[model samples]
Target: MKNIRNFCIIAHIDHGKSTLADRLLHFTGTISDRELQEQTLDDMDLERERGITIKSHAIQMDYTVNGEKYVLNLIDTPGHVDFSYEVSRSIAACEGALLIVDATQGIQAQTISNLYLALEQDLEIIPILNKMDLDSAMAEEVTDQIVELIGCNPEDVIPASGKTGMGVEEILQAVIDRIPAPKGDPEAPLQAMIFDSVFNSFRGIIAYFRIKHGTIRKGDEVKFVNTGKKYHADEIGTLKLTMTPKKVLSAGDVGYIISGIKQAKEVKVGDTITLVSRPCQDVVKGFEDVKPMVFAGIYPVDTDEFEELRGSLEKLQLNDASLVYEPESSMALGFGFRCGFLGMLHMEIVQERLEREFDMTVITTVPNVGYRAMTTKGELLVVNNPSDLPDPSTLASVEEPFIKAQIITKSDFVGQVMTLCINKRGVLTNQVYLTADRVELSFEIPLGEIVFDFYDKLKTISKGYASFDYHPIGYKESKLVKLDIMLNGDQVDALSALIHRDNAYELGKRICLKLRELIPRQQFEIAIQAGIGTKIIARETVRALRKDVTAKCYGGDISRKRKLLEKQKKGKKRMRQVGNVEVPQEAFLAVLQLD
Candidate 1:
């Protein structure tokens, strides 16, 4: 145990955490030169293409220094705010973290947030300033900021360039010396924390865990503390890029246990695992299920594929415990699933993965935040969809979820960013100048206000120099109403949304206009109206394509042409009264894109 070091790399997005992990893998000779790939730990193609880590990966490596063999377990974590919960769980399973910060970009919102998460776990943090090879690298300034903000020793800061492998050896040596070895009693009753899990077709659910107090071996009967389901460990292995079977995993070690549990829902992340025969008297602390922050409806473009979509989500959810979904039906879109996500990025990734990995084409409705509704009977309910909201007469008050957002940007664009935030109904809580040219601003904003396009606008206003991170601050009272879109007097629940009452009219008008532009003209005129409850707030008309009814009567008398036109007009009026508007799928997507 003295020679074993368990740690993870934490950083802001695009801060070279993956590159650093790759460098360590190469320097330690854990992977052959011929097999070495850039960002080897990032398994997903989407992650590599986007130059970001979406999933947390764990790998075990062996390094020999001064004739002393050491076992190093490195967990590489995602840096986006959307994956903060995953990061926290990864950190909890480690003893130390390498806090990587870009020398040029310095500290970002996610950087600070992740640093605090590491601190909260009481883990050793080694401040590493990466990208020293770049000409614009401000190593000295970034080092000072780390020391001041993180309160770490100035001399202990390590400067390295991931691209050039500079200081790679020194960083590895620091890990052996600085990060403490995991301490656990191997003789104690078995207790392990399942930090992550993956499903396999042949092997069933493989649970990735950190043994906190005891040893686990093949054929051992283990019980999940939360679910109370018992299973015999079919196999035991260590993750060395790929799974390597092992007979036993001692205490203070990180590894995987494969139980023949066919169902993925049986094994959950952040659940405690113990030997069923010799169960631990108490389970490990700090295990909490991830709660989704954003909600949206996912439906198949072809209604017949609903079952296929359901199966795909189930398989995806097996790997991603953070994903939450339940069956839902739409008046216009038919049967679908109402899904919950950590954030917008997570939602997008899930949709993309469903399409690419599962070969499923799905339509995602407008995302929404969970709302608290109080019925006239004094019952409080959480509504995930606008259509789920009760009638206004049956509701007493409503509250919307809010977040405390922290933004870091260049001081030159502070005014522009502030204006954008204010326009989104963000309330400024604090502002601080990090440097002469860099600033950090905090705001308490409604989650609904920023879930759509606030981040994109913030980037545009700041010229892509701004970074933002947020956490839920709970729900607050707001005058919010459900705005429904009606097509030719028929309500379309798929296009319903909850908005602040004050901006309902303008938003309704904008949505109606966007729908008007997207919905195709039919044989009969279509009336697109936005309403709050039974009252219409905004309306737009998509006129039917004009057909020359008098075209057949060439050189005819004016009275004959008039009679033909009048008959055509009467037929059009009757068609408009009974004909149903066919709203294309693109129209629903267009409404979501509306600003």
Candidate 2:
């Protein structure tokens, strides 16, 4: 156990955590020069294309120093705020963390968030200033900032260049010396924590776990403490670049367990794994179920593909335990699934995966945060969809989720950023100066205010120098009303949204203008209107495509032309009365993108 070191890398997005992981893998001789790949731990194509780590990955490496062999377990984690839970889980499975700060970018929002999480887990932190080869690198200033933020000695900081592989060996040596080895009694009762799992078509559910005590071997009968389901361990393996079969994994070892459990719902992340024959007295603590923050309705473009979409979502959910979905039907969009996500990015990724991986085109409704509705009968209900909101007469009060947000930015754009936040219904809580030119701003804002384009606007106002992170605080009382869009006097439920009463006029007007530009002209005029309850706040009309009624009558009598025009006008009036405007898919998406 003394020769075993387990650690993870935590950093801000685009701060080179994956690159450093690749360098460690190469320096340790875990992979050959020809076998090495860029962002090797980022196994998803979406992650590689976006230049971010969306999932956490673990691998075992063997290294030697002065003829002394040591085993290193490295877990690479995502840096985005949406995946902070994943990062926390990874940190829990390790004894130490390498906090990587870019020499050029210094510290960002997620960097601070991850640091606090590591501190909460009581893990040893090794600060590393990366990207030293860049000409703009400010290693000294970043080092000072790290000292001020974390309050560690100056000599403890390590300078490394992930691109050039400089100081890689020193970092590895530091991991072995500074990160304590995992300690547990191998003779104790079998107990393990499943940090992650994946579904296998042939082998059933493959659970990735860390053995906290006792031993696990092939053919051992294991039971999940939460679900109370038992299955025999078909195989036990250590994860290198791939799974390498092993006969046994003792305490302090991290590996995968292939249990002959076919159903993905039976295996869950953060669940305890114990021997069925020698069951432990108490289940491991610190396991909490993940609840999604944003909700949206997803429907296939072709209604007949509902089953295919359902199957695709199920398969995707097996890998992503945070995703939740249930069947839903919409008046505008037919049969579909109302899905929940960790955030906007998670929602986009799931939609893209369904289209790119499953080859099914889907239409997604506007994303919304859950609302709390108190009925007249004193019943509290949680509403996820705008269409599901009860009538005003049936409700006593309505509450919306709010978040405590932190923004780190340069002082030059402080005023502009503050204005932007205030416009989003954010109330300033506090402010602190990290340096002469850097400031941290805190605000309590409604989650619905920033769910769509707040981040994009913040970047635009700060000129890409601002970083933001937020967490749900709780629900707050607000005068919110459901805004429904009506086309040709018919309500479109898919286009309904809940908004604060104060901003209804402006938001409704903007959505109406965008819809007018997106909807194509038809034979009869289409009246697009935005309304709150029975009152209309904004309206736009898509003019009909007119045809010359007397185009073929050359030198005809004036009376003939007049009669033709009158007849055409009457026909158009009748058509407008009974015609149903067919709204294009683009119009629905455009309304969601309204600024």
- Give each model's whole-structure lDDT: 0.90, 0.90
**For every model shown, what is its TM-score relative to the native structure?**
0.97, 0.95
Best TM-score among the predictions, by candidate number: 1
lDDT of 2 by residue, 183-230 (tens): 888888898999988877788778899988899889999999989998
Cα distance off (Å), candidate 1, residue 544? 1.5
lDDT of 1 by residue, 15-109 (tens): 99999999999999889998799999988889878888888999999999999999999999999988887898899999999999999989999
Give the clashing pairs for model 2: none
Worst 10 residues of 1 by lDDT: 282-291
